[model samples]
Target chain A: MNDLAFRLRDARATLSAVAVFVALFALYTLNHPAGFSANVVQTAANKGVLLAFVAVGQTFVVLTAGIDLSVGAVFILANCLASVVVTGSPGAVALGVAAVLGTGLACGLANGALVVYGRLQPIVATIASGAIYFGLALALRPEPGGDVDSTLADAVTGQLAFGVPASAVVLLAVMLLVWVPFRRSLIGRAVYAVGSAEASAYLSGLPIRRARLLAYASAGLFSAMGGLMLAFFTYSGEASASNASTYTLDSIAAIVIGGVSLFGGAGSAVGAVFGALIFRTINDLLFVFDLDPLWQPLFLGLVLLGAVSLGSARLLRLKNRLELFGS
Target chain B: MTVPTTPVAPAPASPPMSAPARRRFDPAVATAFGCIVALLLLGSLYSTRFLSPDYLLQQLQVGSFLALVATGLMVVVLLGQIDLSVPWIVTVGGMMATAAAGHGPLGAALAIPFGVLCGVAFGLFNGLGVAYLRVPSMIFTLGVDAVAQGLMVLKTGGSAPQDMATPLMRDLATGRALGPVPNAVWVWLLVGTATSFLLSRTTYGRAVYAVGNREAAAYLSGVRTRRVTLAAFALSGGLSALSGALLAGYSGKAYQGMGDGYLLPAIAAVVLGGTSILGGRGTYLGTTAGVILITLLQSILSVVQMPDAGRQVIYGAVILAMLLLYGRGAKIGA
Candidate 1:
């Protein structure tokens, strides 16, 4: 009975967010010019997957009660590096992919080291690292033009059999390979324990530091994957500060919409993916409805505020005002 | 629901000292002073022109803008909260002031106040979200930021404004009085002094620090934590808006994204001034020094012809190094 209750509680936020997304997606499909068509789905999938990968990364760090503001920087860094390195022969492209991912891991490790060992606040530390990463990206691609391995890019970004999005398939493959294994691992449980109650987790002899480190490192790895996908989509690299900052903000929005608590310790990468899709669909919905592009930011802001307000509804029921501070 | 056996304790380990010592000397201020002197020496090595009053004062004029924004950010930071709506609030202030100025003499005269009031109103919205709604300040301010951006975009119709700054604004921003000192520097000094007084001398200031240290405890001890939070945020907004209005005056017109570059630097400046990022500890003098340091650093970087990428890298590295240095002593999230 206790185990059942725990599972239900854990799933509640994710479930509600999913319900909201489903309704919105339905609304989007109904209004779109080519309603429910493969082309529409593929386009939405392509756009959504980039944020999904980054949101998944954000989930890892936020789950540990920390945030990785550097994810977007790493994403852009990977994009620039990949554009430069992922050209030439097929063999060379593979090496480039590895190198891009490796750089992302290094960035994540740097953030983790500062937060865990140097004892700097996660937000500020990542903000600093993010600047460095973005600087490196700007140096790599001073202008916006570069070439990627077209064959590899096309294979990953194109439609699969029967009009399925190859991007969607790749996203699923990633979840299976990365998130699922981590979710089941002992370290995964420790990540939750630490977020929920650090003192208790420490008392239980958990490898608290290692769990936090792994969470940050994995976040970096996923962010790099997102970057690679971005390069594939654009077929070039642009070190635009505005774009990097937007992605960072959007990733946070995705996590919130996906039912991940900013206060930490609950949510899944799958839920985050759903959240990213929902956020992207909102943008797509604007297009279908023919709203002014100027209205998009305002509409997004309202949605975010409403979602956050809804999340805070639990505060009203508290008996002690002290609980208000913690919540 | 069963409460955990051991309650999650707050992170106050060994307080930096047994009691808050009333030390006349702050190491942060002293260090900042030293850095300023060191930089002057270093820059003179590049060119004798660097030591000229005209050149140094010019840097101060520009530094004044950042110092104004940092003043507000420091207040919010003191409450252990952050306000990310600064960029847009700034834009709104400048836009509103400049747009208002085009109407009539009254509009021109009230342009600065009109801009500041706009910021105060937005700050109230930010405050309500944080204090009353219990929304996290970071996310709430970000949402406010987007809303502000949209409003500005709609108002401007996706282009530069058709209006320009009034003569009064132009004078306040660019005109110099007292011979060598730019008018903006005087304005910055005035704002800095007022902020220092508010943070160090007033009852509200004491309440701010108390709330920052521990909100629940402060509340229990009869501090109106919500009111303090609301006031701090409002003040922060007003100051940021004031800076924006001055910037409009400086440039002689309002433009989009005028405040984009200020956000990170303002935050960094406040932190550099020895104001804790986590809040409840810091001084305005430190922030002032930090602003000067940052401005001088920018001048130095540009003199060397470093690319934008290199400048950003150095800024980021500086933030990280400062945090590590300051944070090592504080038991953050142990």
Candidate 2:
């Protein structure tokens, strides 16, 4: 294939994910009673951004062919910590933000350590660490009532110029600062190499350990950002088990929809962000169509199944049955 | 310059076949049993009643439910896959059984099987996706779990179901017909024996292990790998549901979220028993020991009046520590 054609082929999954998101989001907006208003867009953006952040975090770990079940727990931990610490003074709020972020980083690093050094599988290690993080969150906010800095929360959640959501802007800034840099960095490339073929990557003398550690650490940072956004939106913190589990599952779903291969070594945070947006839109579409709220889970489940099935269609093209086992 | 090629040695007519080495007992099972004993001793320190036959039997009864769920999970794990749908499938089993029981005599009599059948159906769906479509079992089962949760929610309208367990179900879950042994324990023993027989003696069971170790190699060796995968998942679904049904009986009614607590504990039990999460290398006996260990630990925690947070922390810590101790060498390439 020609270079341009090769690039396009490489980008096909992400492009398709974007297209799907646009189509669903358009359908969602058009069916709404208040058609295409900034208020509606802002509300949607605010909701979508939370999952988008978590999905971005998930993208990093997944890119390294590792899963982080503890992302949601870390998010909750950050939220709980933010609620308590992000209150006092402007300086104190800044410190609180740093503390929350640091905690997330530490959690991510801890998970990386367990997986890399302890040699535990990502799924089980995260499950165990997730429990620990959640336990800490529960201890921090046993009753679920804590405060955030109102001015900051309002400002961040509020709209900016041209009715663009501030949260969306922050997400963009994050993408530019975190995602772009990582994508261009040596360790980032190593992450992809490791995910694609760990044995080969190791043989090639790639920094597999550092790459994985960075991937996990970035996941933690992004999840913390998500948690911080959640606190801003809610103005309080809750160590809700359902919320934690739901977000973790939803992030994985979003990544799949965004065209990231769960098998790893492909896709992007951009795709994951769109996937998160697409998922949020699906939920809102039900609201616009006057479906019973009870139908939401069923609808979401069906959409996920359909999306996953579509992704698996390529398996039918495999000539050798052996190809199906490893991939 | 003349290049010299090395002469090829003649191949041996046939290499002598050596008898298979006798399998040794797994140290992990021993470790799990050791933990169980330690937990029992710790419990006895807190309360003299811990050693009583009634209390120990009660613990056994509770542990039986977990054992059943773990049995199914172990099968799937043996196939190198996982079923995250256990929690919701367990709920489906309980709800469907209880719902059926509210109908008539026939419905009451068939309630348990009905629940198990529903579980099997869901399991088959999971199997179809993983085995045929080749969707990753983790993600596929997770989606199935969501779908199950949605269906149950729709069925119950977000409230507790009205149907109570039938007398037979309750008797199966709680009653001790054979002196001092809970009926649940009896049920578990029966299931365990059947599973042990299947794993050790049946071609299909051997196929499950072979497929789990290397699906490609197993397929090359004439194993119906896809069928094995499907069957394992179905078994997992059915057993998880059976556990749910028994739990509903223990509680006298099925409720929403009744199965939410089983998924992790089931996986943990299987792994603690030395079933490699990667699949193909575990025993039914190890899982039994692991279940008992977990139950005793839980009992001890409750006895000490640890808060939920502390329990969670300790539970996670113990799992992590145990994993680090024995689960360190099996590394994922990624």
Candidate 3:
């Protein structure tokens, strides 16, 4: 019974965010009058799929108390490479997928190399690396215009059985895969230990370096996947696609909103996925309201700020309870 | 090179080396400096134009603004915070100064001050959130950056400044004084010198360093950590604005994204100059070298006709190698 309660309490962050999503959707429905339309649902599903994927990538890195600023840049680089290498042939699409995944892996390796052996702080190292990657992407295409396989895009992103978005299925699959290890795997628990206390983790003989390197690598790969899906949605190769650069922050906000600790050692992948969904709903609601695009960033930042402080406040209250109870 | 200082708990009792030996070479500083030198040397060898003093001086002049802004970043880094708002602030400041020059010389004066104050106000806002409000500087500065960037875009209407107001401004950028030394070079020298002196000699400087090294300790020592932090952000904002104003005078105009180019380089210079990103240790000298090195490399590459992306790849790789070599030095300095 106690274990059940603990598990239930652990899930509160996801539940709360979902509740917010429902409330916001309600408000939007009242205002739009034509709400619950299939198109709106499909758009939300598509947006949520892309955002959820990116947030999942961020989850691993943030779990280890580091960040990957280069994710957006890497996302762009993968697309650029794909646009250059991919073509009309089925083999070309296959190669394109391999090439993009390879690009992501290589970029992650570069970041991991610097961060691990170079003893570089993840944020600074990734920022510089991001600039270089972005520079390369710009140099490669400079301007935006390249075609991805429409068939491939449609197949992956189009509706599934019962008219559910295919991309939504992919996102759900990722969440399922993540949840298993996150609960039972020692490596996953090691990540939490490392984030909560680095030196302690090291002293305990964990492969802190390997874990960190792999975490960033996973982040890179997942971010690339996100970019692939994003490209499918846009259907055009844009070297300047990541120029908006808010995608990185947006992913992070999604994670935080879902109840992940910024200081690390807490949270779930599913929580992050749910966070992205709520955020997507809020953003869609804003569009329904005809609010300025600029307001999205401001609103996202404010919500993230509130979510984080609230999360911290809850932790503090728990700490107080533990102190009083002498747990 | 591990000092074996308590990483927050008891360690195996082992005296690794003499305390002085542990003290001399901070790995991070050494690595960053090594990267700078290696890049400088490689740049010099790769391009025939690098041998020419005339070619070299041109890069130095162009590099001054980056160095100036970086020196301010160095101070902030000492406090273990990052400021990403410099680019737009510089661009806006330059734009304001250029536009105000039409108001006459007096207007130029007003505009320049206004630019600095604009940055200062933003910095104070940053200080308020990061210091008093206990917010993460990253989120606060980035948010501030977005707000500033939006205002700049709104102000410029996504176009370049139509009127730069004077030939004097361009002359300031291009004119040479004593033996081919550019005016911008002189400006860089003064800023570097003054900053170095202020950081090294003054009580405030020491206090800043102390606060950065250990805020709790500094406060326990009654060093008014809040004021020092506020001042650090203020200085960062002010210097960024000053650099922007000068660039405006040099470029004879300001574009919407003019300061964008300088942002990364400014941080790069500070980091390469041996300033620990985690803060508490830095010097104007390292920042000076950093600016010079980046300028030299970029100029040499331009002469060699290497694409910017290629240069960047080499640059990133080089910086990484250097960090690997000297990261230990950085932690000690931190």
Candidate 4:
């Protein structure tokens, strides 16, 4: 019973996030003009999955108590790169994907090096690196035109069996292949330890540097994946400042809503995926309710504020004021 | 096995500093000033016009906008908190001021103050969340920024706002009230002086540094840390709004995303000025140097006619290099 209780507690944030997404999604479908159609689900899934990928990436860094502000920039850079190279024959597309992913890894490793080795603060370091990444994206696509391999794009973005989104399936596959194994690994445990209490973790002889490096590298890889998906979805790439900043902010929001502590050392990528879905659903909810498009930012903002405020409510329960400063 | 308890010995005291009489000059501030001079020289190589007093004064005028924004950011940074709501608060200030101006002459006269007050209100909201609710200032301010963005969008209906800057605002922002010196530059100097005085001379300023250094310790010492945080954020918001209002005046109109370009640059200037990102350790002199360095660099980049991409790359690279030079020694944690 104790074990079960501990497990439940561990999963509480993720579960609540899942519940919120379900409730919001139900409202969305119920109010949709077309009503719960595969097309509607597929479109929503496609959009949500893009943010989900970035959020998952953000989760890795956030789990280590650091943030990857460059994730969105890397995502956009990958989009630009993929649009240029993820075309032509199958082998060419494969090579292009590898190159894009490699770039993401390089970017992540750079951030890791700056924070871990160079001893720079994560926030300022990432801000500077994010600028560099966005610059590269701008250089790659001076204009807003490029093409992706249509066949691959269609296959990835299209609906699959039983009206399931291919993008959703891909997301599940990533969670299973990437997040699950990582979660069960030694380094992953170290990542959690480091976030929970870095000094103690270091004193305990954990691989602090390696764990942080891997976390940041994985963030880069996942952001790259998101960028690739974006290329497929849009069939082109643009070095859009608005899109880059929006995704970065939204990814942070999704992670927060997903119950991942900004203080780090808690939560799962699964929660972040749900959080991303919930965020995407807010837009759809507005659409279905016939609200002005201009109201979207306000609605999204309110939801974010509510979610964040709800999370911080636990602060009121602390008996000692000193405990307020603990985390 | 019985464990024997031993009494802990007092820690040995170290010797007193031999250099207690050393001057208070900060090398970081010196280095920043050095960079600013180097930038001016480099720009002169591209165009002799850069060395001309007219051009240099003009750059300072243009830089005052950013300087004002960074002044606010420095206060918040000193408090060991950040306000991501700066961008939207800035926009809200500009838009609201212009919107107010549309009412009449009285409304026009009150526009700038109205805009700044709106920003103060948003800052208070951010402070409440961070101080009382204990939400991370980063995410809390970001949420507030979104709300501000949404409100602006709803008001403007996703288009350019119709209101124009009041004549007085235009006069203050773009006018050369005292010879070649822009009135905006004078305004910035005034704010800067007040800030310098606040950070160095006031008891509240000392408390801000104390709270930033260690909140629990500050609290134990009877410092009203929460109120300090609140006041710092409010000041940051007001200044950011003031900068935005000036920007609107300079441009003769307010628009969506008008404040977008200032956030990163303002932050960069603050940090570049040798202000600690983690809070509690920096000088206003350093920030002033940082603001001047950034302005000169921008002018040089434009003089060379570098592409936007290259400019961004160089911009990021320079900030990173400077950070690597002085902003090292942080541990591997948020």
Q: Which candidate achieves the best lDDT against the true structure?
A: 4
DockQ of each: 0.56, 0.64, 0.28, 0.71
Report the lDDT tens digits of candidate 2 across residue range A1-327: 899999899888789888988898889889999998889999999999999999999999999888999899989988888888999889999999999999999999999999888988888888889989998998889988799999999999999989999999999998999888888888889999988998888888899999999989989999999999999999999999889988998999999999898888999999999999999999999999999999888788888888898867788688988998883
The digit string of per-residue lDDT tens for model 3 on B118-200 reads: 77877787676666555556666666665667666656653555447356555656778666899888878888888888887
TM-scores of the candidates are 0.95, 0.95, 0.85, 0.96
lDDT by residue (tens digit), candidate 3, A143-236: 6877788898888878877777788888778667765765577777778888888778888888777877777887888778877787788776
Question: Each model's C-alpha lDDT?
Answer: 0.87, 0.89, 0.73, 0.90
What TM-score would you give candidate 1 relative to the actual structure? 0.95
lDDT of 1 by residue, A1-327 (tens): 699998988788777778878899889999988998888888989999999999999999999888888899999999998889998988999999999999989888888888888987787788888999999999999999899999999988999989999999999998999888888898999998888888788889999999989989988888999999999998898898987888888898899889887777888888899999999988888888999988888888888778777867887798998887773
- Tell me the tens digit of each residue's lDDT in model 1 across B1-334: 6876887788665546533363456676677767778888988998888899999999999999999899999999999999989999999889988988977888889999999999999999999999888987878898899888888888887665555988877888999967889999999989888888888889999999998889999999999999999999999999999999999999988888999988877877887777787788888888998899888888887887889899778868866876675644444344
Best by DockQ: 4
lDDT value, residue A56 of candidate 3: 79
**Candidates sorted on lDDT, descending:** 4, 2, 1, 3
iRMSD, model 4, in Å: 1.8
Error in Å for residue B244 of model 2: 1.2
Candidate 4 per-residue lDDT, tens place, B1-334, comes to 5886797877645334343222157777888888888787877887799889989888988999899889989989998788888888989989999999988888998999999999999988988999889899889999999999999999999566557999888998999988889999999999999999998889899998898788999899999889999999899999989988998999999888999988888888888888888888888989999899888888788779999999989988988998888778645444
Candidate achieving the largest TM-score = 4
Q: What stretches of model 2 exceed 4 Å from their correct place?
A: B1-22, B158-162, B330-334
Rank the candidate models, highest TM-score first: 4, 2, 1, 3
Please give the RMSD to the true structure for each candidate, in Å: 4.5, 3.6, 5.5, 3.6
